[model samples]
Target: MSLSGTRTHLVQTARLNTFVREAGDPSAPVLVLVHGNVSSSVFFDALIEELSDTYRMIAPDYRGYGGSERKTIDATRGMADFSDDVVALLDALEITEPVDLLGWSAGGNIVLQVAIDHPGRVRKLILEAGGSPYGFGGTHGQDGTPTAADFAGTGGGTANPDFCARLAAGDRGEEATSPLTTLRAVYVKQGFTFDPEVEQRYLDGMLATSVGDDIYPGDSVPSDNWPGSGPGTTGTNNGLSPKYLNQRAFADLDPAPPVLWIRGEDDVIVSDTSLFDLAQLGKLGAIPDYPGEDVAPTQPMVSQLRAVLEAAGEVTEIVYADCGHSPHLEHPERFVADVRAFVQ
Candidate 1:
């Protein structure tokens, strides 16, 4: 939102012109940050601001989320399509080689898919509480486990307190309409648990950003295909399915690209999983343990990740004690420091 940064346009998925941010020097190594669903590139504002001085960074809002226009009903774009958007954006920027990739939560899943689908394009993989259909370390489940719904109403029910703080800080950047309005919408529409102040700040900051009469452009999304079961499916499969039922979007990975698991112990959504046995530090039935035994990896969360990489002969994992689902957001200094150490 700050006009001081360089802005560039890239065409992706249906020739839709997408906006992206470029910070630091082109000569420096590149870093791409992908955000999660129902959120925009703005989510990475703090991280970007911190990293801009050292590494060249790019963060683009997926269609239907931020400044980008929604996809028309006649068109559609899925996870693969979104990953392709990343590739297209990179190609447009002439990033012919792999760059450090950081995907937070759902964005982490997207980044993993990108690395899996197109190896050699990624130098290092960093997944922040990233969920995968194939389940990494089997710590998460195939269906994300039912416990996730419990968090639905937690954390202010999607009430972004950070966005509120930014607003109070006099940041007129691209903010949601209002913290209160968003909080009300969350309770009414999504059943979230958020504070009114968040909504108030959202409204205040939103007024600062120029928005149309309609703030959300759901009607403009390219794809509305439903899975007919679980989460937001339509049960019809719509020639496509949700993560719970679809693989066309994320392919079955084979010894997938070396992975780095970065998670926060405090994140309820990403850290607290019913499937995980914190005592065992692995899933009950999904992870590999002994050679040819398919035993669960007995390593600690980070150590297990490291063991997985060591077994693969090339991967890295770093865990922050005080971090949550998004260490980059929760512990920016340490997160960026660790990432720079690995990437450089």
Candidate 2:
């Protein structure tokens, strides 16, 4: 089943034409990798190379991101579309049995949705720096109480406009918010670096992201909340807002799968005081009108996930020291070893 070659193909699923990178023997156990926001399956290339021998590897670009078709993402579904798309991919591939699923960041949200909605299809779940069970923002406590009914402090408007513009323009410069700079600084541990050629490939996948109100950062709504912004009725990040997203139902799965929650100790993107979250920014005076913790405290993302998973049973937590948002990229060998052991 071991193989060194990588192959790319367009899987014609009922939902959208998915672009997949696969390797290893077809007869082997399946390992599907789902990537995060502003990123494609390209980030998993190194991990695939390291684990290809042990299991069949399949990494598919989600509909709006990479080589996949630029289909519209309906934010109201609360990641149901992404979850359904993955199941459709498995169906198209004729993968009847349960498969090991691994998701990173936003993809972590997708995998949890799949496990909750289609429990039979997932044998095990790996959440790497996944979004909070309460969703991305506008929450107060571990219970994920909305800071505002509109879920203000979250959604599409929060995305850095200059960054989105640069991505749309395919700017390769190293200035702040540039795709390359983000890939290095925010995505991984600050000093960790990827091979120059591979970095270029991943950057191409990142820039391939469809920039609009219906995708990537998504849309927004004005709110009475401190930040004065809230989740819109449409878009990806909005879909993830507490108003639309919550996977606490995962604890109710009849035959809950074993879960591996792996995260980087230094991951600023998904931390308790996430830089991307407006609530944290507001507390730090990064945003105007400093709100006290009672109004908008740092969303306890890890605590929320733990509370749900621990209730479900058989959850293992691993925090990688010195790692950032992407453990697979910042520490590939360790990530590969841990995942291989988990799946095996």
Candidate 3:
């Protein structure tokens, strides 16, 4: 497909106005793409362009992201705010038939929730470096047991203030923690270089992230655990805390849709030993007063998902070697080919 003619629109859903991008024929079988935390639909534009000829690609920005109406994301709902909003977008667009769903990072979790909650509306499911079924943090063991009832090692407090500040300021520096650096170093394959022309648009999408206790990082509680912080009641990050989110129940879905779990083999954000995880960093002595593994062992996020999907018995996983968190960007051709074949 030619890399041109992408259209953007704002649709009035029941909850709020959602900003969406569309490519390809409207009547083609839809492939709904959802992006992760701190990003918007724009991140999937490339993937959409590549697959547009085969599918009607629709990517929507969640509330408080991109050009969507900014609103408080209720963490207590466990991504229900995002899932419901997606459902509303589909309804508003009059998409009654089940659609193929693809999501990356936190968005992956949202699509899973949709499949679990509304099986009739999802034809196939794809999770691209999705968060753990146990949620983002504060868990141990393959079963994803919470280290503390409060999920004391996870939540908004886990975010680096300097990094958040830089994002808010739209800092384009190549420093270790700058948004651009993070994108280059962590979001893609180690040696991959992003196109300079498209980098600023991605940065703009990242900076559009809403910050606060009720938003991106959410709130936190004091913890006896290492680093001394736990998940609090609200925010997009907190919503993924083990305190409120779990996708193990996904195995219970009847007549479950086939799932494709595609990820970069080098992903640090959602790996068995994630560099972004507090427990992993704590064990590495990066955080002071580090508690040994007994108290808060690193959560095997990939192992957890595999177990859940194995139990469900309809998952196909693809690991792209030499790739990072965003396989679509790191290995777009393979990613698109995998998605196309899997959906077919």
Provide the TM-score for each candidate, comma-separated: 0.59, 0.97, 0.97
Clashing pairs in 3: 152-230
Weakest lDDT window of 10 consecutive positions for candidate 3: 1-10
List model 3 lDDT by residue over 1-344, tens digit each. 11477889899999999999998888999999999988888898888888888888999998988889988888877888899999999999999999999989999899989987778899899999988888987887878888877687787888988888898787888898898888887878677887887878888888888777767788888977677888888888888988888888889888778999998888999999999888899888888777788887888999988898888879988888888999898888888888989988
lDDT of 1 by residue, 148-201 (tens): 221111111122346435533545443454444442342122333334444443
Runs of candidate 2 exceeding 4 Å displacement: 1-4
**Preferred candidate (TM-score higher): 1 or 2:** 2
Ranking by lDDT: 2, 3, 1
Give the TM-score (vs. native) of candidate 3.
0.97
> For residues 222-323, what per-residue lDDT tens digits would candidate 2 score against the true structure?
888778878786778888888889888998887789999899999989988788888788888888896788877888887788888998889999999999
lDDT of 3: 0.87
In candidate 2, how many clashes are counted?
A: 0
